[model samples]
Target chain A: MEKMTLSSKTREAQSPTEQWMRYLGFPGGILLFLLILYLPAGAGLSAGAQAGAASFALALVWWVTEPFPTYVTSLVLMFLLLVTRTSNAKAIMDVLGMEVIWLNLLAFILASMLVKTRLAKRMALWLVVRFGHKASWALLAFLVLQLVLAPLIPATAARCVMTLPLMIVVATIYGSTEATPNNFGKNMMLLNLACISVLSSITMTGSSANLIAVGLIQNMGGQRVYYMDWMRVGAPVAILTMVLMWILGQKLLFRMKPEEQVPQVEGGLELVKKQYELMGPLGFQEKKAIAIFGLVLFLWMTDIFHMRWFGVEISAPFAALLGAVIVLFPRWGILSWAEADIPWHLLIFSAGAYAGGLALDDTGAAEWGVRMLFGGMNLKGVPFGFTYTVVISVMMYSHLLTTSKTVRTLIMLPIIITLAKALGWSPMSLALPAALCIDWVVGLPISGKPNVIMFSTNQYSVGDNFKYGILTCTIGVVILVISGATWFHWLGITPSFWAVAP
Target chain B: MKTLRLTAFILLASVLAMAVDLPTYTVRLQAAPDGSGQGIATIALAGCTPGTFNLPLGFTAVQDLRVEEPASGIRLESSERNGMTQLKVTLPPDIPAKATLKVSFRLKQVFQIVKLKPGEKSTLPATSRTFKHAFVNTQEYLIGAYRVEFLFPDGLMAQAIREQLPKPAKNEVGPRVLLSKVDGHQAAILQFNKLQQGDDTSMIVELVPTRRSFGWLIAGLLLGGLYLFKFKDLVATKQP
Candidate 1:
């Protein structure tokens, strides 16, 4: 194992053409901003809201192309809103400190603690060694391990990094090195990437994109989707997807050799065991970190129960912050301020995006955009089942066109909610399911951060990802549709196709 | 001869009551921290004889209806007609002249988180927590006065108050208390002397964060930090 710096692993040098394309994003955003501001306001939207629409457009362009750092784009968007009087300074500033932002910050801090305490490494090794008797079992072991780590580590990329070394070691043991990749290694790596990305959909705070989607839903006059509700709707689908991916990878997609069926390398399990032993033993810091996070998870899952008994509602973000504060407290805490890996860039981007969403809703720009884009479709008369299927499919396949999950969510969710409302359907029925698709960024190498990171492993080609990725994505869509119609129906999330609209 | 004279006087009083109009009713609402409220409706019938008094409530499931008047103890019955909950108080046969009735009951009140428009600034302090309480008019007749006093939760300080209604005289229930506002609603804080009718009222109150939450936050961080330092070696890295 080698020591790795976070930035060095994630950052790649840009090509001249790519750099020029990124530079184009700035003027492109400015042009869009001016175009939206000058366009004739219709549908009874206020001028302030129209201006807000301009800032949202600007942010969208920059977010998609990355002319500036995502956080810098966020800051620029806020400043534009202030200058254009789209929103007041207080409102803009207040958003930066919102509880959701803190939640993301806290989640990052918790992830950092896990990394620093070496708890994640230890947990991964123990799972692999315990479940690595057979090739199929080893693959399932990694799949299960990634799912377990999904909720605890919010960043998909971070999870990939944590598990990558173990994966390489396992591949080497099977004689499936990167240069001569075997069916087993391809299956393991591809499934590893796919499962990590897919599992993020199950937890409310599993990914930053999920949080942004929730925020957009709340901004659109919908009730907050708590942790329990998200899990109930998303977890079954995620589990089913993982099952299908495993079957496809093991039997159908990647052909395994007889030698691959069992551990051929004598010391493979020893390697993992050695890594586990290196951690020495769980110390006080590990115990404390575990205890604090355990409390956080407890509070998050039982928020409603606690609210009933204690009269104070413990929101997901607040619970996370509570855990983070304890973990970062000086002298007794596991991490110092400098050690905490809070992603300010992502937070700033979120704050700006939230502000833009607020402006859109407040200024009636979203409503207007909804009217313009969907008004002529006559979607109201369409059958609920058909409408729902179309919505889910669009959300699933949209990953092919964009890279950033947050950008995808920020653009799609508001429109989806507005369209749902316009169609006289419940916003949650459409928006929440659509939001779940934010994690399905697996259609292409450039579709998501995790996909990109996995692609860089050199074990699989673009053709490999596209072939398997499309198959599983199609299967995932089917599973999601089934859940929306049956499971979601049972939960009263969606009414039966012929039932009266809510 | 005395008995005959008393009967004639009673009959004469009953006839006089038939000509007098119903007294005006005033409702005062006090909101609690847990989102429930207590309301007192005072009926002033200074010159009229007691008869069937009907009170319509803006909210439903009225509970604990306590009436103070009619020494014989009048029976109170509730019925829903035309989607409205009406409380019917049957006045005693031997009614007093120039009487006032006080009716108090408990009703559930909903508070919503305040939504600010883009670029709209809140008057509440940055650190103040806020919630909005709405008062709707369910009565058909004009109300003499509508007053509301919002009680802030303990450890929270009321920094500023905003109301939906215009030109309301603001006062403290004790000292330095503020209320919140809703658009197009009128409500008076701490004082109920003003006369308002038909229009709905809402109030928003901003409460400054108390040391309790801050203290818990700080204390939890410090304690957890200390615990980590004590057991820090468990996290020490070992490269294999």
Candidate 2:
């Protein structure tokens, strides 16, 4: 198992849907595009709007089925938007320069700082050594580590990279490997994946998708969502979802035996401690990384006080940028320019998705579609709970359709905002909760970056990931629904009892 | 002598037996981005006569009115009526009596400085332009079909507000229902089939311009270039 290559682990059996999509997704996307473009529908829709919808349809199908790499599909999407005249060349090209894209770049830089100094691994090792006496405690240790690292490191993939080796070591101690696996490994791997993905919802900077949602709310909904505003709603819901997922995985889904719960290998607990001791004491670079990360986290948390403290507020991107600048500031900084692990391809993907979404909006295609949808559904007299539930469920489960959370965010949030506005509900009321669901990208290996990393471990099968992922997502939907009625109501993000539309 | 007189009178009466029939008039009104408008009216006439045909142009403050035969493309200026502009078309003496003529009347500034009423404020940045264009059959003779089209500017995206208007009575012929074809190239079309003499049809529309801008494109390119040049190798290895 240890000698197995990464591709061998990643090349698991494909589900029927994936197989079909792999074969026919490209041509199917083209067909859909042509059909929507030439169809004599919606006499009131503008030519630009019609063209925008067609371009988006093609991109959506291609992104979901993945006929090409998602980034390649995105490049194609950008080209389509320009050639189809759905959006101007300048607008489509400018998507790479959006503030959300910048924030994602700076965030990866900050993550690289933590990873370069090995502070992330050190922290994870310390937690596991402190709490790896039992299998249950070990899992909780990882969960806690994820919660700790989520805000400090905005990139989930980076967090997963830091902890993957540790998870592999601990799984081996439990006598679980690709050749021989057990319930303990399944629970361990799946729970950690859920943790890394779900805990990201706790902060607005947790993912690129969250920031895009915020930008849409500000631009389209005319409501600015501050960092604290997101945390005020997102933190509770995400933490609860993580806790429930842990419980469901340990107690119900993957129950370990008494001996399996303990380390099956000799001196398993000692091994973790030995690993922690091998790291030795925290070095000067680790200390510097901590101080910089701490300052950044402090500024992020204390944004509400910035206006009173210094007569101005430091935005999330600016805060991350300041930290990144220090991390690369001459010899005093920890990393050289080359050391920063910025994924230009992912940025390209993000730019194209943003361009498509903005084109739909600029051409009024998104709004027109939303209006037509509501007009057809006749949701005027429906109760608010039902509507909220539908919106929340769709958003939470939308990971099954598209793998990229950034694309999903660009596709859904504006329509959700428009839907809410069309229905006379507050856009934030629906969009914020949906935005909180952006990081629940754990339903498949291709669902998220972290899932891909964790899946490549090969300690669990695709079936295990799927079953556990679907159950965990359903559990998440229930938690969010209840929170929408109770916790969010108490926080006033939603109405109490959902008595009346806003 | 009496037989000769009867024959000459029969010829004169045959020449005097000219009649005119107004079948349909389709008017196309196009609005410019600068708030000006132009219109083209295609009028179908049968039973041609060598006499003047007074066609009422249902527009206010019409300017640069020009008429031409659709088939021949021959430009001709028709006399206009004061107060409410009417086209005075003179049929030629050599026109075949059985031939139906199609004449095109082109008018500029048909909607001169239309005063668009302001609508309610919305969360969107677009401002609303609300106005009404009335299509009235000012002719004394009944019109077979009177069609009017109001078109928005090219490449402009807008949303039509759903304003409720009272339905026409069952016994009465209210103006034909307004069909807003703002989608694609279709305009807001109003068709009044068999419009009675001097009857008018009008509908109000509120158009909200939904144009969006793409600023900071150059800035994006600069940043992207800097990243590519500074960390170009990362792009090869760190592809997501």
Predicted model with the maximum lDDT: 2
RMSD of each: 17.1, 17.2
For model 1, how does the per-residue alpha-carbon lDDT over A1-502 read when each residue is reduced to its tens digit?
A: 2211122122221344444445555566766776776564432344456668777777777665555555677788888888665677898999878665666567667777776776655665666677766788888888888889887766666566446656765665676665566788789888988888899998888787898888877767366788898999988888889888898888888889888765545666676677678779798877887898688777765665876888998776777778888988878889888887655655666677677766665444554453454445666767677778778887788666544677667667766787788778988888888888889877665466566445545566555677878887888889888888899988988767665445
**Residue A299 lDDT in candidate 2:** 77
How well docked is model 1, in DockQ terms?
0.02
- Predicted candidate 2 versus true structure: per-residue lDDT over A1-502, tens digit per residue: 1222232322222455565564466666776777776565465565556667787777777666665655677798888787655677888888777766777678667766776787766765566567767788888888887899898777676566556656766676677776667788898899999989998999988887898889888878888898898998888777887888778888898888887887665666676577679889999999999999788777766666889998998876688789999999998999898888776766666677667767765554654554464456655657777888888887887676554677677767877887788888888888999999999988866567677556655667555788888887888888888988888878777765456554
Question: Candidate 1 at B70: error in angstroms?
Answer: 48
Report how far off residue A58 is in candidate 2 (Å).
3.3
Model 2 lDDT tens row, B1-240: 999999999867754564556677777777776666777787776656665546776676677665544332222445545456666655666755444334443344432334435884442223545446565566555777777777766544334322322333222222233434643444666666666766776655445444323222343345435544654332233346
DockQ of predictions, in order shown: 0.02, 0.06
Report backbone clashes per prediction: 15, 2
Which pairs in model 2 have colliding backbones?
Answer: A44-B183, A45-B183
Q: Model 2's CAPRI class? A: incorrect
Q: Per-residue error at B220 for model 2, in Å?
A: 31
